[model samples]
Structure formats: structure tokens, C-alpha cells
Target: MMNNYNKEEIEKLRDLIKDIDTAMLTTSTPEGLLSRPMMTQEVEFDGDLWFFTMKDTDKYREILHDSEVNVSYAGKSYVSVSGKVEIVEDMDKKREYWNKAYEKMLDTSYDDPNLVLLKVNVRSAEYWETGSMTKNAVNLFKKMTGSDEKDPSDMNKTIKF
Candidate 1:
């Protein structure tokens, strides 16, 4: 799938998610679907998403059971990414995305053996973005005024990665 992506489309998808600070990572459990907030790695969106996790965590176990997952982000725009995930243990890769805050959040250093990375190899993504603040404000006004017309400034796209 990665081989089929054109440079422009990848950049467009990257632009949509670039400023998102957190993503809701969802995995399937025996009971149902479970979602947890995950800190978004401050790196370029390169057809994959990276996350930090502990080896003993529920998400880790769930991923082992079913590698399929969903990750969603809401900022000025909203993005939902469906992908397959696997546990990654390479220390160098972990260090590349590491930050001091993670130490405080997980109560462990990056060097801890319990530390692991969730590598989400994106399959497909859908995003909805409201073009600009002014346009969004106008849309809001129209909605409040009981206008039934759809806003032209609203944008939506689906990308197969």
C-alpha cells in the first residue's frame, strides 16, 4: 500500500494530522471495543503512527489477540485511522520518539525493559476539516439561523495507504 501513495496525497494527510496533540487508540477486546487516549508522537506522519506503551498493559495484550486497531485525532480537523499494530522493541527507534514527559507519564525511563512501542501501520484514513476559522464561524452562524444548506467550506476525504 505504501508503494501506491503519491507524494502530494501523503503530504495532504500529514498536514491534516500535524497539529493533533493526542489520538484515541482503540483496540478490540473480548468484551467489546476499548479506547484510550495516547499522546501523539511529534514527528512527521509517514504512513505510520508511533505510540509508547508498557508490555504489561491491556492494550498490549489486546493487540496480541487482534492486531487491527483504530486511532482517531481531533483538532481543527478530525482524522480516523484504521491500521494494524504490532509491538516494537528496538531501543533506537524508541529513543527517536522519546521525551522526558513519557518518563513521568509511564513512571519509567525509556531504557526500562517494560517499555515498548506500538507501531501502527496505517491501512486507510478518513478526515474532515473545516477550511478556516472564518468559514467555520460562518457555518456555525448559518446553523444557528436555521439554514438547512450544507456548508461548502467543509472538506472530507478518504485515503487508502
Candidate 2:
């Protein structure tokens, strides 16, 4: 399916997730779905998320078998992004995202042949945020009074990119 993203929606998404540093990246595997915590790249979001991984990892193999994946983030709000994974081997692009943290964690430089970048082209996202206590209480009062009004939780939204 083609992603139809608007600037406002994209910016909203970026705003929600910009402060979060880590996300659980779920990839389809032959056995089942596998999820692992991955450090999210700090670059400004533009419908894509990037991660650094070695070529020989299980996630890499899983991505090769099935590109479909889900990435989830949690903080003040919860966000789940569904997308396709693209394994990038471009040296320049790799260098652009490379940092000291990666060098320390992976014990490898950006020039390492085994290092690869996984680019997730986000297709859609669903986010849930807890509303203010006042709003929640108002929704509760409405429900108790038999008012057919939407609950505060109903504010949770799903946006298709």
C-alpha cells in the first residue's frame, strides 16, 4: 500500500517520538515475531527510522526473509509504527548516522563491511496518550450519566502515512 503522509501529521508524529531514545523493533521470523530493543537514531523523523546492525545478526536475516516490521516506543505517550525494512550498505549514509556510542557498543567503525543500516519506511502509526485527569473525570461523569459521549481514551489515534 502506498503511504499518503501530510506535513502536519508527520510533524505531529515527530513531536511525539522525538524525545524517546529507544524503541522495540519487531521483525517477522520463520518461527514467529521477534522483538528487541534498539537505540533509535536521533535524526529528525521524515517517515523513516534508522538503526545500525551487523549484517550477520538474526534481525538482519529476518528482515531479508520478510521486510515487514513494527517499531514501538513508550514514554509520556505510546507510539507504534508499522513499516518495511530496507538494508542499506551505503558507506556515506552509514557514516552520516555513525557516532561514538555505536563505535563503543559495536566495537566497529562506520567503515566496517559487516556494519549495515536498517531503514524503516514507516507506513502507519497508532499512538495513545493518557488524557488529563480532569478530562478523564469528565468522561467518567458522562458515562455514569448515560451520556453517549466519547471517552478520553477514544482520543487515541491511528494515522496512516
Candidate 3:
């Protein structure tokens, strides 16, 4: 069973990543880890991240073989989330996240049987914001001085769900 997430942390994480539209999804493979760029579903995140994929794709097979995954996003900030994925075939959910862009990119409609949703139950996330140079320099100076105190504007943080 999934543990309850802190609402504040969930909201903070959602705000940080909502603007990032694409993510690199990494899945475990027998050989090693495989990663591919996937379009993130434009829905409010509440400890779960969603992506669309084809049933026959390598990612789908990979998820089946090993559910553990990592999703990384880059923008003004960089975020990496660790999670486990579950294949979802709910048509309502597919339609809810579907859009013309997906149709054009996938060359299929939401009703396509091959199209499915990968619901990633996020376990934890680490993020780093690209702060102003002054803040970064100060942080670097603090690190160099071996200061254990964290600045309120510290660029990096980890959130656990």
C-alpha cells in the first residue's frame, strides 16, 4: 500500500515540475538502465506522474519486467523522481489526458487500444533550482567553509512521498 504524502510537499513538487513538459524516463533492464524522453501528462500531480506509451513499445516491456523507474525533468530547475510504474488502460483517463499534440505525435486517437497510460507512483524526488549567481556563489562559499547551516534559499531539496 502507498503511504500518505504530505500535502504541502506534494503541492511544492507539483509547482516545481508543472511547467516542464517532457521527462527522461529510466527503467531497469537486464543489461542495464534504459532511458527515453516521454511527454509528461499535463495534469495536476498528486504524488503520481503520468505518461502515454504504446503497448508494444520497449518501455512498456521494460516496465513489465521491472516496475522501478526514475523520471528526470529539466527546465529552470532540474528534478529527478524515483517511482514504480503501473500500466493503466482506463479509457476515461486516456481521454482526460489526450490532446491534439498527442494525436499528431502518436498518429492515433485516445481510443487507440495500443495507446496506454503509465502511472508512476512517485516515492521521492530531488530537485535543484538554478538560483541567481549571487545566491549560488554564496552557497559555494558556504560549502567551501564547511558550513553545516542551510540557507533559506538553498537551491537543492529532496521531497519524500
In terms of TM-score, which candidate is strongest? 3
Model 1 residue runs over 4 Å out of place are 1-4, 131-152
Model 1 TM-score on a 0 to 1 scale: 0.86
**Candidate 2 structure quality by residue, lDDT tens digits, 1-161:** 22457888888889989999999999998889999999999888889999999988999999999999999999878899999999999999999999999999999999999999999999999998867778768777887999957655657899888
Candidate closer to the true structure by lDDT (higher is better), 2 or 3: 3
Model 3 residue pairs with clashes = none
Worst 10-residue stretch by lDDT in candidate 2?
1-10
Off by over 4 Å in 3: 1-3, 137-152
lDDT, candidate 2, at 13: 89
Estimate, for each residue in 8-112, the C-alpha lDDT of model 1 and write its tens digit: 767888898888888999999999999999998887877888899998988899999999999998987898999999789999988898999998999998888
Error of 1 at 65 (Å): 0.5
**What's the CA error at residue 145 for candidate 2, in Å?**
12
Q: TM-score of every model?
A: 0.86, 0.86, 0.87
